[model samples]
Target: MNLLEEFKKNPGFVYRIGTDYYYIGKWICKPCTDEAVTDCHAMYEMCIQAKEPANAALYFQKLRAYSEFALDIPYNPAKILQYQTALVEALSDADIQSLTDQLRHFHDQAS
Candidate 1:
């Protein structure tokens, strides 16, 4: 199912920011453009804007999936590979970004 649909399974958690819908514990939908708000961009804008440890961890989880997608791109106009490396380093065991809580229930479910 789509990300929005997935979020629908659990109500009252999805956060709507401008035209996009950020599933607090899931992902951020692409900006609306007169079309349906579909396709959960693996790397969300919130991920870039995350600050708090709990929220960062949530966004970080999404970043992990994004990092994988980044490595699969063919043309690579978005420099996703660089982003992938940076995220990996930041979320590494060395605590480069200093991740503390796992963000399991910070915003949404453990997933």
Candidate 2:
């Protein structure tokens, strides 16, 4: 069976972003141009509504990380810009830099 058919049969299957058959958990749909953008906005809203700044910061960081991992194409100008913007808005400079450094180190080691 094709990816869409497989995803339909098993809703829990994880689907990576930027693929044709991006799973929304319950079903698979064609790639949506604003999927990531919508996710970012939703997360941002949730963070804003959070009672604690710490919780807000945590979720914001998660959103930023997900965006980075989902958009792996460095050459894609739009993704690069979106990732940078999300990183900046979601984290303080020091924290974001620290996380970036740590991630880079981990990636280097894995390679």
Candidate 3:
């Protein structure tokens, strides 16, 4: 099967294809997108497994922390921009797109 198909089955495997994006295999992106996706999914799962409100609160704390670090918004804007710029500079178009997709997912899942 094609990489797109694979990604459709499992979004955690998003990868680059020339200038395009495809979700297919194992790739852990700590920059902004994939890492965010992974963390968001983890949070969702934790929420699902939460036996008490305290556990869910812990997951929200973690989610907020991850998002803050990744987006770099509300704490030293210059530093956050630098961090995000470095990642964007190093990424291919495909990576950026995939990251964007994952980021959107992260946003939805986070809330």
lDDT of 3 by residue, 10-61 (tens): 3233223233432221222233345554555455445645644455556545
- Mind giving the per-residue lDDT tens digits that candidate 1 earns over 1-111? 122233323322223333343322222222223222223332233443454446545554554454333333244423533442443343445332222222223233334
Query: What's the lDDT for candidate 1?
Result: 0.33
Global Cα RMSD, each model = 13.3, 14.8, 11.6
| lDDT of residue 52 for candidate 3 | 48
Best by TM-score: 3
Alpha-carbon runs more than 4 Å astray in model 2: 1-44, 78-111
Clashing pairs in 2: none
Model 2 collision count: 0
User: Which 10-residue window of candidate 3 scores lowest in summed lDDT?
Assistant: 22-31
Best-to-worst ranking by TM-score = 3, 2, 1
Report lDDT (CA) for all predictions: 0.33, 0.38, 0.43
> What is residue 35's positional error in candidate 3, in angstroms?
12
Model 3 per-residue lDDT at 16: 30
Single out the weakest 10-residue window by summed lDDT for candidate 1.
96-105
